[model samples]
Target: MMRYILVGILALMVLAVGLLSFEWYRGQNQAVAFGAPFELVDDSGQPITEKAFQGRPTALFFGFTHCPDVCPTTLFEMEGWLDELGEEGEDLQAFFITVDPERDTPEVMKTYLGNFSDRVTGITGDPEKVAAMAKAFRIYSRKVELEDGDYTMDHTASVMLLDRNGDFFGTISYEENAETAVAKLRRLINEG
Candidate 1:
């Protein structure tokens, strides 16, 4: 009986160590030391700055209009969360930054975001400028050529959450549902 008790204690210690290691890994991955400030044109051609989004919780997604699967699904989920927020949703801002800047012109961005909530803002800028912003956000994107001259971009699908002070708070993976996403945002907002 003493031998069995010792083995159980050892197993529990191992499990505790594993759980702590996993949490540490997650914290390291999500840690943002510093992010560069950027200026980009919104769908309305209005200049948007990192300062403009300060004092409010912001959720940012990197995507393009031609995205075949991920973009639409993510946007739909985001819209549902916005709907759930109701009037207080106005306190939150959603930004869709296009990786395919060549084709995702301001006009294209405007049209693409039309179906969603009015709170959603689509942004695209010169290729070089967009690339710089993507690097700042630690977003990875690559273009794949098609049969025609057209091309498609594969980009990171993680949704970044920024605190009211414009600091990087955390990110919600694509696997998170609207409710989970909202819960995280609420916690961040309240904490700020």
Candidate 2:
């Protein structure tokens, strides 16, 4: 009877271990599947694809040029991060995707990004395409009208970090300091 009890306990332990291993594997697979493919026109009106970002860490943000405050602040933070990274910053690419595609034409994108850094790239596309991409990235952006004929966009102010293989590594909140963001980005690049 003692021998039977020992055998049952061993079987239960093995089952538990198997279940834990399966769960871990599932979690890893989900992480690997984080990002989806997207296509848009770059500042120069050239077609850009997920393949373009492959083998390089990418920092992605969604905003419009018409943004009054948050957008410029975020871009300035990114510039500071690049300065912190120095030469290593070249290895990382920054993409600014405009949520207000109706107004953010390729020319506008180019000019807006130029204020931050030449290293920064701007992307805009058809409204439907931009909306779909924003949905995929879980970005929230909405247009808010003001007394003036112009409008402003209210968007989530988080920067997304994509791994070298174009997987969604993680994000840095807008509230984070430039130093903190740079450290996180460097760690992501090194790990990848």
TM-score of each: 0.80, 0.86
Best by TM-score: 2
Q: What is the lDDT of residue 151 in candidate 2?
A: 84
lDDT (Cα, tens digit) per residue for candidate 1, span 1-192: 999999999999999999999999999977755457888899999998778668888889999999988998888888888888877667888899999999999999999888766778998988998989888889999999999988899899999998888778889888686678889877766765
125 Cα displacement, candidate 2 (Å):
1.3
lDDT of each: 0.87, 0.87
- The residue pairs found clashing in candidate 1 are none
lDDT string for model 2 (1-192, tens) is 999999999999999999999999998888745555778899999998778768999899999998878889989988888888888767898999999999999999999898988988998999998888888888998888889777888888999998898778889998697677989989876864
